[model samples]
Target: MGFLLNNRVGHLLIAIMLFVAVVAVLLLIAKVADGLRGKARMPAVIAVFAGPALLMLAVGLIYPFIRTVWMSFMDARSQNFIGFDNYVTALTADASVIAFRNTFLWVILTPLLSTTIGLVYAVLIDQSRLEKAAKALLFLPMAISFVGAGIIWRFVYDYKGAGQDQIGVINALLNSVGLAPVRFLQDAPGNTIFLILVLVWIEAGFAMVILSAAIKAVPVDIIEAARLDGANSWELFRNITVPSIRPSLVVVLTTISIATLKIFDITRTMTGAQFDTQVLANQMYDQSFVFGNNGLGSAMAVFIFLLVVPLVVFNVRQMAKNREVRG
Candidate 1:
């Protein structure tokens, strides 16, 4: 059985068959319930449908969330209640403060820069010659994993001892130009920006794809009318294109924000969070596993959840508003 399931085709076939079976059963139940009247019918339908969904949500999300929150208030061993000490330490500790600052920088810079580049590139390639090829080339970076990209960029930024052979492309270029090699990764503040640029590079492709679709969805008639009314290029973009794609913009920004907030792989792969390059997600890992401080880890995790919740809520509200407007 294991050998049979190990094959991709066999696994897909079984999954499809199982899904069809479940759907068939659900349809059969719905058909039978259609003939029944009033309270019993409604209750039966709810039991058949909503019960499983609710149960899964409770098991998957609710329970784990509650457990994490509970642990955040407990001690390192989770043996005694420590109140707000973990939270205080997470906020005030020097390492955590640095982590928060870096995270703030990443959150602010990544989405804005990536989205801006994507939007501009999308507009440029929207109707350009060889548009598909151009967009594909731009999006090629997204195909690589963050760790893989980090490793690649790490080589690009690799530094060597003075008077040694420079193997890194950047340093090699500098040496060829009769300049000194720059510490691209080892430098603080600037190194963080360099790392953020990597995320921007990957995310720009995603942003371009989404924003390009949004751009295409803008009403051709509306754009024509705006142009006929003497609206310049900038005016058309500002008033018509942007407003038309406002919902998509919200979605792209929020999605990028979420990705930025959860940034871990690149930082870990590139810097190992050394040299003052730590963020919340990596800090959470170091605290929980590396340093054996589960309580602090849980607190950091909860803090991350807190930071994300408002953005998620805002996104949900924006989606609802868009739906309402469409309706």
Candidate 2:
């Protein structure tokens, strides 16, 4: 059994057997449901379908969340109750303080910059001759995984000491212009800004795609009516286009904000959370896994969850309000 579990062919066979077992059980459930009376049949069928899903959710999501919250109040070894000490350390520790500051910078800058750039680009290319090509070109970066994008940009920002042959595109350009190469990843404060730019670049395409659809969905008749009323370009956009797509704007902004808040890949791949570029997610991972400080890590996780809940709640409320307005 151990050998079978370790072998590739055995793994495939085991997966196939599990799949077959699940199908047989589902079939048996359906047969039993069919034999039952009206009320019993409906309830049994519902239970057959929903029971596994609910069980999985309880085990996978709810249990882990509860465990993490419980651990957040315990000591590093989870052997003793430490109360709010871990939370205090997470908030007040020098590394954690820098992590929080950098996370704030990411949350603020990535969403706004990506959305603004995407909105402008979408507007500029809407109904244009090369709209498809232009959008495809802009969106190509989005196809790359965050790690891949980080590696690509690492080359773009790579630096070497003075009087050395520069291989990085940005540094090479600088060298060509008689300017010294800048250590974009190694520099503090500003390195965080450069890292934020990578996320913006990758997310801008997503923002443009969403906002473009929203812009196109605006009522053409309303646009014509506004134009006939002597509304100029800026007026039409400000009073018409912006208001019409406000819900989409909210969605794009909040979605990107949530994603930015949970940022891990770019920081991990590009800088390894070094040079004060650590965000909450990376810090949580390092504390819990690398340093074996589960208490502090869980505290960071809970703090992130707290920060995210408000954004998610706001987004849902806006979506519901939009639905009511449309209805």
- On TM-score, the leading prediction is 2
Best by lDDT: 2
Rate residue 214 of model 1 by lDDT.
88
Once all C-alphas are superposed, what RMSD does model 2 give against the true structure?
2.6
Task: Provide the TM-score for each candidate, comma-separated.
Answer: 0.86, 0.91
lDDT of each: 0.91, 0.94
Model 1's TM-score against the true structure: 0.86
The local lDDT score (0 to 100) that residue 262 gets in candidate 2 is: 95
Candidate 1 runs further than 4 Å off? 1-37
- Model 2 poorest ten-residue lDDT run: 2-11
Q: Number of backbone collisions per candidate, in order?
A: 0, 0
Which residue segments of model 2 deviate by more than 4 Å? Answer: 1-28, 323-327
